[model samples]
Target: MTFKKINENEQQNIHDRSCMILVNFNSKELAAIKTVSGFAGIRDRIAVTSKNGNTKIKDILDGNMVDDNEDVWSEKAIIFNNIPTNRVTGFLDGLKKMKIRRPLTAMVTEVSIDWKLNTLIYNLKEERKAIAKGQFVDHK
Candidate 1:
């Protein structure tokens, strides 16, 4: 996975491609927002707006933030499905090719398995309720 510096325009692109939200842990309300959005998985974009505001996406599979700076706080707007595997590899390759200075915390909004899990949970809850109330159960 590779991290790239994105401007507001790029941020908008990310937002357009997938569901996302701004994540700020420094403030209580923002943190709660993060929690809810994360649970929903509908918003894959995460913007960590606190501290230096410098952010980058971390590659959970690779276990790296994809940036070089460590002081900058990870204020990111995640793009869940924006970066595909090939694109991710290409990004890393581009960084190596250009010898660009990687940012501190990498920002990624790629869709995660959690999204499906959440959906499944929601479905199960609805189904359980239906069964409990005998709405869909066989009455005969």
Candidate 2:
């Protein structure tokens, strides 16, 4: 069997091809969201709205986290916002495996969170398998 290598640029392109999903969860679910957000460049994409109506996730992860009450991550919060991609579904499943609630989005009714998240994981696995198969193909 012939083998091939994927270069850095190809890796970047593969990552770029992955899509992003904007997830919003109720304030009471902050800890749950933060725990799952650990997956996509998400621990960083995390953001929360303040009691006074200011958004703070970007600021906090950007090294602005402080002791100020206004900076409280859970202030009478609405919902945390995060943009997680296909790779992030691993953590989503982790929650499901443990029988915990998966973070719900403010969008996409009629479809369940499990269905949406599982679809992303399914597509990603298929893409990876295709790439792997190509890498092992004989090119003579």
Candidate 3:
């Protein structure tokens, strides 16, 4: 997996709208995999955006914050957005293997205190495989 820092200046749009970090992945590897899977023309590979401060994964996915339930918290939250479906499934599988609850956006604020700090930012090349089912899972 490869990690390349995006220029802060270039992320003004992302920053202005949300308290999130943005990272881009090389789609070449994903494109190759799609070819093998007979999805060669697929446009998107995978993208991730994380945010600190009180927030939920659902909010991130929906592009806005939602009312928190009694079991949820309002501070020091981590929100992971735009995770690919294959990756999400793999993550749930791994959690099941370790007897961890499937990560839920609603429960994240209640459970993970250092959500932003501990949340993964990037994984490229082989690391992607560790996180997802695709051949070139890159999250290192």
Best by TM-score: 2
Worst lDDT run of 10 residues, candidate 1, spans 52-61
Model 3: runs farther than 4 Å from truth?
1-78, 106-140
Error of 1 at 97 (Å): 1.0
Q: Per-prediction count of colliding residue pairs?
A: 25, 1, 13
Candidate 2 lDDT over residue span 41-128, tens digit each? 4544333333322323333323344333343232121112232324344555655665665433221112212232333233334444
TM-scores for every candidate against the unseen true structure: 0.24, 0.29, 0.24
Give the residue spans of candidate 2 off by over 4 A: 1-55, 70-84, 104-140
What lDDT score belongs to each candidate, Candidate 1 first? 0.35, 0.35, 0.30
TM-score of 1: 0.24
Candidate 1 structure quality by residue, lDDT tens digits, 1-140: 22233421142233234433243344654454445444444434444333312222223222222233334433222333343443434443444455533222222334332232222223334444565576652211
Query: Relative to the unseen true structure, what is the C-alpha lDDT of residue 70 in candidate 1, on a scale of 0 to 100?
Result: 37
What lDDT is reached at residue 44 by model 2? 41
Candidate 1 clash total? 25
Q: What local lDDT score does residue 61 receive in model 3, on the 0 to 100 scale? A: 36
